[model samples]
Target: MSLAVAGEEHEESGGRLKAIIFGGLDGILTSFAIIAGAHGANLGPVPMLALGISNVLADALSMGAGEFLSSRSYNSYVLKEREREMWELKNHPEGEIAEMVQLFVARGMSRVDAEVVIERMAKYEEFFVDIMMKEELSLPVPSEEDTLESLKDGIAMFLAFALFGMLPLACYILAGMLAPSLDVTSLFSVACVATAISLFALGAFKARFHDKRYLYAGVETVLLGGACAAVSYFVGRAVSQFAGFEQLEFVIQYEQQPTVL
Candidate 1:
């Protein structure tokens, strides 16, 4: 591939990576909060695990669909802009040529030199097309391969959420299963600490893209996770209270449900 093609591919890769980071972090933090809150409110391990996994699935699917739509929207805008440029080049060749010459002059070329270059380039249709695309239009036509690659990127982003999001919730749930002796609150505390550290690390990594302070990103991520956990815990308590006697009976029935030998 030419340098231009290679550059465009690289940019698409960067965009996909960005999507993965944002979606993955969102899943991780959101699930962390829900699981932590459920645990804190003394919800049974089964219910807590079910809720966390369900949220992970729902959030991942939502993010993946959103990414696909956003990519399509961006591509549509670029295509429309390119079509507009093509029309301008077709209907007003002289005006487009003059615009190109002026652009070159603005970039430090002498007026006479810029005009001469434009004249020579206009003699070659391909050269003129390239100049208009690079300077006047500034819209690159993405190849078929690029479009497929972008879809792949969207899928990758979706999967990232699934993988990263399950980490904390899985840690807590599995810990409870493997060691029923340990209290859920204690298990949740461990999960929260682990989740906070992981999110802080991710936030720091994200700073490479946005040039934000590393400490601020780390603190923000950790705080967000904590806030989510707190809210979920209270919500679970409220739900349990509202459900009252029916909920207690349901919990008993759920617990008494026979396990297959």
Candidate 2:
């Protein structure tokens, strides 16, 4: 690929990575919270599944939509600024050229050399404006295909949230469907371990992207997930007790119900 194509691809990859990290982190934490809280309250498998699935879908959509709108708004702002720069260049060519020369001088070029460079650049209006946009406004022009790229980012976020967020509830879901006679507590315990592992793996992936220490990043993410789970679980338990919810019996009765012919 040409340099420009390579750069665009790199930027696109970076955007996707950001969306994945954001969506995955949110998905894991939110799903884990729901599972931990429900388990602490001694809720039944049906109710836990309902909460987990609902949260995964609803929150994933919200995050994706939010990202799309935010990206569009940023692009709009950048375009507006570029328009302003274009206007200034048209109405004040001499001043703009002088500004470019001063910018080059500020960067350690001799004044005469700066003038010569600016004069040559000024021969090409588009190139001159680009240089001014970068040096004067400190704004790099975005890729022309950013709209499609933004859409890709949103889709990536939604997929990541849906897939990774299901980790904490996956074990329970599988057990309920595949082995109804299995111990509920054991299933939940397995789900907790899976969630921890997922969080660590996500952090390691993030660290790899940012060139950080993978082990430390993994540990940090795991600790964060554990802390969130602990808080949600304890708070749920406390509330259930205070309200006399009696969720344990309800769950037991639900599990014990006979299948109707």
Candidate 3:
């Protein structure tokens, strides 16, 4: 049989997977933290639902927009650097070649051999600049489609955050709308369960993009999320107790509710 590849297959799609994993993790933790805090402060499900939904929407938009801007800025910077490299290569060929020679020698190549390779590579200007970018700057070659890539990244992050992050709040909203008579402790317990499941599942999903085993990743994520949850609950309880605050009104007002929390 033909030899199997000795290395893992390259995946351009890994960027999207990265965004989803990170965004989902963020969503799950934030939503759960909010739930835990609300529970500690004795906030009702209706308010929890409102707060959770708001967090998801606002954070998702922020993530998407931030990703787009960051990606675009990176692309622009790379292009500028490449242009500078090209200019130097055109005007100051000796310095660029000398720099390349030094890099090769630093990496354990003989001076003569490094000079030979650089001479051959320098004959092709585009290839020459690409080598300099990689060796000298540790950068990938910039692409014309960078804008589209940014849009994709932003959309991926937004969707991942919005969809996965909504899990904890989703239970509260559903329970409030459909089973209004459910006690607060019972509802919070259900929310905790949902949050735990969401964190574990998202971790498992992340393992598909990495070398980590699914079960290990899942458990690690749960522990991390549990830590965050504990902190959030403690903060809420401390804030309420220190401020001498009473329990919020339990009414689920539909009309004329205050717009701000």
Query: Global lDDT of each model?
Result: 0.78, 0.86, 0.86
The 10-residue segment of model 1 with minimum total lDDT is 4-13
Q: What is residue 88's positional error in candidate 2, in angstroms?
A: 0.6
Error of 2 at 242 (Å): 3.2
Ranking of all predicted structures according to TM-score, beginning with the best and ending with the worst? 3, 2, 1
**Which runs in model 1 stand beyond 4 Å of their true positions?**
1-16, 37-43, 123-134, 204-220, 227-261
TM-score of each: 0.71, 0.82, 0.86
lDDT of 3 by residue, 154-230 (tens): 99999999998888888766776688787888788888888888888888878877876999998899999999999
Clash-forming residue pairs, model 2: none
Stretches of candidate 3 exceeding 4 Å from the true structure: 1-13, 245-261
Kindly report which residue stretches of model 2 are placed more than 4 angstroms away from their true locations once superposed: 1-15, 245-261
**Superior by TM-score: candidate 2 or candidate 3:** 3
